[model samples]
Target: MRIRLQRDIDRLKKQVVSLATLVEERFRLAIRAVECRDADLARKVIIGDAEIDQKEVDIEEECLKILALHQPVADHLRYIISVLKLNNDLERIGDLAVNIAQKAEVVASKLELPIPFDYVTMSQRAGEMLEESLNSLVNLDLHLAYRVCAQDDEVDFMKSAMQLQFAEEIRKAKEEHIEPLIHLFLISRHLERIADHATNIAEDVIYMITGEIHRHKGFEYHHSEE
Candidate 1:
């Protein structure tokens, strides 16, 4: 029974990792769609989301089967729980990528609109955080997970700065520019949400590694000004 459980857990890890890889790819494509202002590319990301949705369902079913059949104990039980938690986070991240793609679809139509925020930098930061968070999970590295959690505030700060910039831009823009500016603001919001999900995944990794409930303890490192 123990041998069978380990086999199932190993298979679960590969499956979840495959899903993560696909999600990361979609996220990168969504970012490119925004950067290149390609509506078609954005639509590709949107349409491809069905794949993610299907994978999420499949992973959930697998988790349930493992729990029912194996009744994992202690460390094994924690790992299964962590996978269940991170599976949702990964799926939500995929949805957030679709949201970004949808915004890119809108912004792509208005080529002349001047972007007021440093969205490129913000998107890059969010993407890095996401990749690193998944890395923490793959390695079950507690320190890496903590580092990813600490970086969440930086993305939050960037989003807040974007809000201020967008407010000023909206005040200055004509009626025609207002609509696309709103979409750009939403794109920034989506990126921040992705970062948030990434942080959640990292926290789950921490839980898996140490069996410690690290959420909402306010232990995350903060920037000097934050």
Candidate 2:
């Protein structure tokens, strides 16, 4: 029973990693679509969301099956629980990618305008956070997980600044450009949400490793660094 349980746990890890990679690719594509205002790329990201949804469902079912069949305890149980929560976060990130893609589509349909903020930089930072969070899970590195949590503050700040800039742009822009600028602002908002989900994943990794709940405490520590 022990060997079988370990095998199932290994399989679950691989599945979660696969899902993470897929979501990351979708997010990167969405960012590119926004940068280039490419409707076709945005459409591809939107279409790929269904596959992500199905994979999320499959992972959830597998986690439930392992709990029911093996009844893991201690660290093993924590690992399973962490995977379940991480799985949900990855799915939500995938959904946010689709949301950004939808915004990209809308922006692509409108006239090109100068964005008042640096969206590419914001997207890159969020993408790095997601990648590092997944790396922490793969290596079970506690420090790397903490670093991912710390980076969330930077992303949040960028989003807040972008919102202020958007408000100013909306007030000054012609009526024809207002809608596209709003969509651009929403894309930044979606990227911020992606960073948030990545932070959640990092917190779950810390929980899985030390079995300590650090969701709030981690935020406090990271916030102090700012």
Candidate 3:
């Protein structure tokens, strides 16, 4: 029974990791679609969302099966719980990628305007956070998990700054450019949301490993004044 339970756990980990990889690729494609204004690529990401949803459901069912059959205790139970939560986060992140892709599709249909914000940097940071969060989970590295949590603040700062910049740009933009600019701003928001989900996954990993609930700990990090 013990060996079988461990095997099931190992299979669950592989499934979750595979889902994470797919979601990350989708996210990157969404970012690229935004950068290149590729409607076809955006459409691909949007259409691929169903696959992610299915995978999430399958993982959840597997976790439930393990819980019901093996009735894992202590660390093993925590690991399964963490994977379940992480699966949801990854699925949500995939959905956010689709949202960004939809925004990109809209932007692709419109005339190009001068983008006034640093969207590339924001996207890159969010992508790194997602990748690192998954890496932390795979390696069970507490330090890496902490780093992933700390990086969320930077993405948050970028979102706030982008909002301010968009407000100013909207004031000066012609009526024709306003809608596309709004869509671009929304893409930034979606990226920020992805970072948030990544942070949640990192927190779950910490909880799984240390049995320490870090949620709502009031651990604040400083952001740039720029």
Which runs in model 2 stand beyond 4 Å of their true positions?
218-226
lDDT of each: 0.91, 0.90, 0.91
Model 2 residue 105 lDDT score: 92
Model 3 residue pairs with clashes: none
Clashes of 1: 0
Ranking by lDDT: 3, 1, 2
| Tens-digit per-residue lDDT, 56-103, candidate 3 | 999999999999999999999999999989999999999999999999
Q: Score every model by TM-score.
A: 0.95, 0.95, 0.95
Q: Model 1, range 1-226, lDDT digits (tens) per residue?
A: 9999999999999999999999999999999998899999999999999999999998989999999999999999999999999999999999999998999999998888867899889999999999999999888888999999888888988988999999999998999999899999988988988998898899999999899988776644333222
After superposing candidate 1 on the true structure, give the runs of residues whose Cα lies further than 4 Å from its correct spot. Answer: 219-226
CA shift of 91, model 2, Å: 0.2
lDDT of 2 at 185: 92
RMSD of each: 2.6, 2.4, 2.7
Clashes of each: 0, 0, 0
Model 2 Cα lDDT, one tens digit per residue, 1-226:
9999999999998998899999999999999998888999999999999999999999999999999999999999999999999999999999999999999898876645866789879999999999999999999999999999888889988988998999888999998998888889988888888998999999999999999997877544455322
